[model samples]
Target: MNISVNSLNMPLLECFGSETRVRMIELLSRQPMNIKELADALQLSSAIITKHIQKLEENGIVGTESISGTRGRRKVCYLIPDSIVLQLKAPEPPEEHGGSGYAVSIPVGQYERCSVKPTCGLASENGVIGMVDDPRYFSDPEHVKAKHLWFASGFIEYRIPNYLVGRQTVTSFSLSLELCSEAPGYNEHWPSDITFSLGDTVLGTWTCPGDFGSTPGVHTPKWWKLGTQHGLLKTVTVDERGTYLDGVRLSGLTSADLAIGPGRELLFRIACPDTAEHPGGVSLFGRHFGNYDQEIEVRIGYE
Candidate 1:
């Protein structure tokens, strides 16, 4: 159940306060039992067990029914909710890192626009979105739910949200993702020169060594026919100095070259153009399809 505070249902939260209460709930989960039975299992007095039962019943975590016994009618208690899930609030970002910044996760299937060649396809966590190697399927309405996507050539683009206001200015922009070369099945020797761009300005290109499939990805769906399994995690950062790929200098282009500002549109693109020297292909992995279990992560540092 959603542990939302807005519901004002504090009993459920309060019921788990005691170790004895939690143990009682565990016992009830196995099978319904009377107050005497619970006391015998927990080595607690009948009075204490009854008090715990009352708290659990008041919190809607348990239910009780009266049944005819040999001597007289006895109260049988059972668990109400089979399970409880606590959906706590997300933690706030720490106050550091050059005044903090904005960060977002872009799913593999939620691209704003794409143009890809054969050896292309998209899949959700459960199944493929459409026919593989058919670029037409990239525009399918269900593409938004894709957990894995791959292509032989062309590009896919997304617009990163820019939340800066007033005098706030960008210090640096970064994108991290799990990616590898795309092949028919899998080949560790394949290489691809994948390019990253911001709007029309080219950020840099990184050469992926291969399409990894030697072993199964940690989170790959079992339904797949065991093709490309995972990709290497790559991070690209652009600042006043220059562009860096995985912390190494990549290109001379700096932040000014990308024209980043307070209200600028952050059009980010991942491309495997046919003109590259190592145009093997491109395979992108999302949370449910890769070893890293993360989508395209974007972080912008600003003051």
Candidate 2:
């Protein structure tokens, strides 16, 4: 998460001021803990720890969920974000497509084609789309309602809706989505090489650092419990220069290579090849599923 240095963010900035809070962060980093456990570990009263946990929750560093226990309901605390990025200043803007561009939000389950392996499944906010780990479920009619999906290997392809009119030259296009490596439950160290492509043009491969379940995603549903919670938001863009992943150059493939013309359909693919050195797998979180509440966003610029 990126937080800029500004007066408006003083409260969040001050989250690190107290040593107690720092210790709280440290303990929670190891694993989720309840009020009594944290209090006992810190040698403080449960009431005191509750106050600290409240502060952490207010600052968005910690999250608390009420669960049943032998005695009664207990509040369990979990870290929120795997990492934080402090931005003293704004970053350089990515190369824009053109003066005029349109953005589209495509659902994660709206894939036009897919080839997947086990440890694969898709779920809507309401429930699982079909039987988990069954490839045939990917073809289920209900798959389009999925808000989250993962696969051990193979690829999912989507058709980007082209809004270009006659003679409107395609200048650039970009796709933004939340992604992470796929693990059985959760693993902070698991890595996967995920590739992005536009039709036949291989945009590039990005190494997902982990399956990331260290904390609950900001927008993840509490009732939905498995292991994986969120992922890093990645944006792949193809412009005049080349293809870029989150503003970092990923390959030499340019917009021309995408062959995005006026009438031609745009097929974008996210893949985790079984041949990759780190064949950890791939997981995608869509709106109401990941840290960032968003769908597979597409921005198409035309002149």
Candidate 3:
């Protein structure tokens, strides 16, 4: 399940107010279970459990599906959201300030295009979306809810929405996401050269140290296997001056090289170039499944 909200002013606060609901979220986050399973675990009456589940489902906090059962069918409940962000409206710039800016958060699985290869797959906080390494699974309608994705090689692309860029000069562009090297299982010392690009301009590459699974990720579900865990958070920024990786300058390429203009879409790409020395692999993380409790954040600063 995948959910994105522009704000969290009231409804969210109300949804989380109940202690029973909070416990329910905790249990469902680890694994999917039926209503009876939830009731038994919580030691609550069926009526009480049903009420809480209804409330949660109505609020988009939970999702349910029917599965085959001995008599007929059973409804299994699971968490729908990987994370929620409260984005305050950006204030209009004063005349003296020249222009205003805003930010957008894109879900990890909402890629506009992709070319994933073998040893690739997607999963939510609850369970795997489809068979691992099967490229056909990438087209599964349920992919929109993926919180973690990986591949031994290939690329994933996204088109960033150009919001209010026509009236102002885009001063800087930045993307914050969680990533790591990928291995057959888990390797602490493998290395991979991950490249980032904007449109046709190559921003430079960052060498991921290895696939991390020595310890459980901060937000990784308890039911997630020990070999497959979380990733490291990485932020890549591009401004008038140059491209940067976590603040350190990486290349001389600037915003102009990106050709940002009206009606021009920003094509962002993450790839493991075949010519690289390591070519270990790459993995991407989203809010609920990774250590960081945030989605792929794209910020556009205008001036």
Q: Among these predicted structures, which one has the highest TM-score?
A: 2
Q: Tens digit of lDDT per residue, candidate 2, span 1-303?
A: 445577866777888889998999999999999999999998999999988887776555777767899999998887766665565885334333344677778999999999999899998988888898899999999999999999999999999887766677677887888888999987756889999888887888888767877567777888778888888777777898988776677778787666666778789999998999999899999998977678997878777
lDDT of 1 by residue, 1-303 (tens): 224343454656878779999899889888888999999999999999999888776554665666799999998887644345453664245334335586788998889999999888998999988898899999999999999999999999988988777777777888888888998898766789999988888888888767876556768899877488877767788888988876678888776666566788888899999999999889999999876668998888776
Global lDDT of each candidate: 0.80, 0.82, 0.77
Instruction: Kindly list the per-residue Cα lDDT of model 3 for residues 176-246, writing each as its tens digit.
Output: 88888888887755688999988788898888766766556667788877354666657788899998886
Q: Which stretches of candidate 3 lie over 4 Å from their true place?
A: 1-99, 165-167
Off by over 4 Å in 1: 1-100
Deviation in Å, model 3, residue 88 alpha carbon: 20
Each model's TM-score, in the order given? 0.67, 0.71, 0.67
- Residue 224 lDDT (model 1): 79
Question: Where does candidate 2 stray beyond 4 Å?
Answer: 1-99
Q: Quick one: ranking by lDDT, best first?
A: 2, 1, 3
